[model samples]
Target: MTLDEQLKQLAIEAQCHLAKTPERQRSLSRLISIICQSNKLVRPFQGQFQGVYEEIYAEAQQRLFLYLCKEIDRYNPELEVMQWANFLMKKRFFIEASRDLLPTIPKGVDRSRIKRSPLEVLEKQTPIASQVNASLTEEIIQCIQEDHDRLFQTTHIEHKPAANFQYIALQFLAGYSWKEISEELDVKVVTLSSFYGRCLTKFAPKFKAYLSQ
Candidate 1:
């Protein structure tokens, strides 16, 4: 059988067993082992920082596995298993590797909530929360939404006609995580991420110029 068939069988079999049962545990273990062995998942995890990157990846991977274990029932059969896992990994863990860079704020300040400083924005590629004001954020939102020249409208993820750049930018800038956007668009998170990254690289100058004016 093909890999997807195998994954489907394994996922279904694992789901059939009780959450903490030996059968379920074995099946889940087998699933992840296969994923790693196949190298179907991205590895050495792409990160912004060379140092401490692997460390964060390791931690994020462990967390991802745990998340999958508890939430395996939610795994959709229509999608490729590895793609779903990779989406979760990249959405939740990949960028999370940057946590290592955000250690400037002192601990024990407040458990309820805390805000990042401007320095943290420079240190990591995160949501522009700390970098821009409310009006600036709204301005970006409006520019992408207007699509007067269809620049954003014309750009889309290859093979996915509905997944336009404007939609992705609005959702992303509106603070949707890659995983969430992936679910909404029914597109692979990796593809969306690659497209988003390319758009940022290509359009950053325009974005900056827009903000300056």
Candidate 2:
């Protein structure tokens, strides 16, 4: 049987409408393990994994499984299970995991090879004053908003002149997903993320220097 058919069969057996019993729960758990562990289902995330993402992968994966265990009923079978599972993984858990890793990065480290999220960078750097939070984030955000120098406004994403860094940063800060931005700007998520990192590396320090003056 095709993997798709097999998943449907599992869903039927694990339907939450069945009688509430420990045996039913155990059987459902076993089925969820099979679905979550399927190599084909998780290959998308696994294949694209890199840098800081690999560090929390295993932990995030457990949370994904636990999510399926309790919320599998929420899964829309009309959607391919793989897409459904990975979407939840990215939207619900991975975004937060990436944010938690951002502040720990070495400030001077090269970002050429390190893949991090725009959300991870900005969400961690808030205007709040506390021992844990830094004011650098506030300064960079201010520079993006004010742009008296027009640097951020003119710094487009490579050839995509319409996608200025100022606009991209606002979208990220406003809680738009990278996928949404990519679709809107007709760019790949990979390209947009890499460009944002380079922009931060090039622009953030300059903003800080001016702010410190």
How do the predictions measure up, each by TM-score?
A: 0.46, 0.41
Clashes of each: 0, 0
Each prediction's whole-model lDDT (CA): 0.61, 0.56
Query: Candidate 2's residue-wise lDDT over 16-114, tens digit each?
Result: 544333333444444554564466544224443355455445434534554565555676778776677778666555544444445653443334424
lDDT of 2 at 153: 88
Candidate 1 local lDDT, 1-213, one digit each (tens) = 887788778888877987655457557766765665575766533434445445455545544655566668888888888888888776555445344334642333232233446664453455532233212244556777887889988899877877988888776665465556777889765567567656655665565556567
Q: In model 2, where do residues sit more than 4 Å from their true spots?
A: 16-20, 43-51, 104-213
Q: After superposition, how far is residue 49 of candidate 2 from its true place, in Å?
A: 8.0
lDDT of 1: 0.61
Indicate which candidate wins on TM-score: 1
